[model samples]
Target: MRFATYRHDGSTRAGVVDGDVVHALPAGTTVLDLVRAGLPAAVEAGTAALAEPEVPLADVTLLPPLQAPTVRDFVAFEEHVEGVRKAIDGVAGVPPEWYQAPTFYFTNPYALVGAHDDVAVPPNSQRFDFELEVAVVVGRDGASLSPEQAREHVFGYTVLNDWSARDLQAREMRVSLGPAKGKDSATTLGPWLVTADELEPYRDDEGFLALDMRVSVNGTEVGQDLLSNMGWPFEELISYASRGTEVRAGDVLGSGTSGNGGCLAELWGTRGEAAPPPLQPGDVVEMTVEGIGTIRNRVVAGVDLPPVAPARARPRTRKRPAAS
Candidate 1:
């Protein structure tokens, strides 16, 4: 089943989506709340419509599938990691530890935008880019779960665009910590969340979903990939993340960038940094995953903020002897 959070009559509500119709649930309720309330019961009750009226999908503005409590994005694609490392620092191989376990980073959940929303490019970013990924929403609470255990905890999936400011990212990554301002500006989610059961038919031999993912800039197709290219499946990513930590409902985990040139940075590296210009202001970015639907957004110029000046060195002076 499909679910979405949408605005109707100047207020937002959660509802079940079927084709072009959206059957509204109770007022003041949200999809995130439903996930936190437990998936099976929520699915049963929510699909029943809570005895509320239905609204046409066209009449309501879609929001992110839900407001995530926290977001953990993982790098699960080998080619993407290698390509990005080579693209930025001329590195040739993936890190040794990357092969030992799935790695991830936490991001700003407050900076999320929904489908069709405007994405403002971060200030002073000359290399604004987009990452095509799939995000899984946690449906149950668990700690230190094995991959087998984590599989049952996934509620559904959605398309995620981990918008990036490559220039800022490079500067911070040089410190060996991780990205900050470079990634905090915005991350896009949704069109709608498709439940796990809805995708059962697409599962591959190893249980990984084989969805076709394609990205387009303005009217031109930039890249295409398959979710099956992930080196570590979503189950393993979640299990690693939940090791000795709690993963609760409404938390989101991203599948990172797919291998087949899922981002402009990877493409630039593949093509030797030529052609297919980086995203400029007012460029429309559209991403679609075969089973999950599409999310389209326009890049907009960001609002100006006070400039940060470079640190100045102070002159050294001899310290005066302490008074006795």
Candidate 2:
């Protein structure tokens, strides 16, 4: 069953989405609550008593599937990584360490927005871009989980658009550490959550879901790829994330940008820098994963704050020996 947290009758509540109609689950239920209970069981309990009325989806305002407890985004697609490397560094290859394990980064969970919401371009970002991907929501708590065990912990899937500020990211990545302000501005997830059981048919022989991922800006298509192209699957990502740490219910794991041209940075690097300019105010970004639905966000305006200066000392420059 598909589920969502949406605004209805002046209050936010959790509901099941069916045929463009939302059936209220319970008066105070939130998608996070259902995830905490484990999705299948929550569905059984929430629908046991069907007294609440159903509402048309068009009448309600949708929210992110849940207020995630924590968000971890991973780079599971090799083609995307190689393409991005080629674009940024002008050489194409995935790092050797990437093959050894799935690597991920913790991002701000509080920055999430839902489908149809307006995303604010962070201050000082001249190269804002969108990433087309899928996200998995955790259903159970576990530490040091094996890939097989990790598979059981996933409650559902949803489309994720990991908005980015490429100019900021490039500067920060050069310091060895990764994206900070560049990624903290916004992450879009929603339309609704499709429970794992609902996608049984799409699972490929290798266990990766064969979902078609697509992204478009304004009215033009920008990126498209199949989830099966990912070198590592969600189970591997979750298992790796659980190593030496705890993954709890409501935690979100994202499949980092799919497609060879997922974001503007990669596109600009591959094509001429003059083409596919960075996102501007009022640009509409729509990302969709087959079975999960689309998340359409409009770039509304930018934050007025200026970029913060580094407080630490700069690297010392070496002097040539007596100007040889």
Best by lDDT: 1
Candidate 2 per-residue lDDT, tens place, 216-269, comes to: 889898888899888788988889899998899999999888866677666766
Cα lDDT of candidate 2 equals 0.85
Give the clash count for each candidate. 0, 0
Using Cα atoms with residue i matched to residue i, what is each candidate's TM-score against the true structure?
A: 0.94, 0.92
Q: Which stretches of candidate 1 lie over 4 Å from their true place?
A: 312-324
Candidate-wise lDDT, in order: 0.88, 0.85
Best by TM-score: 1
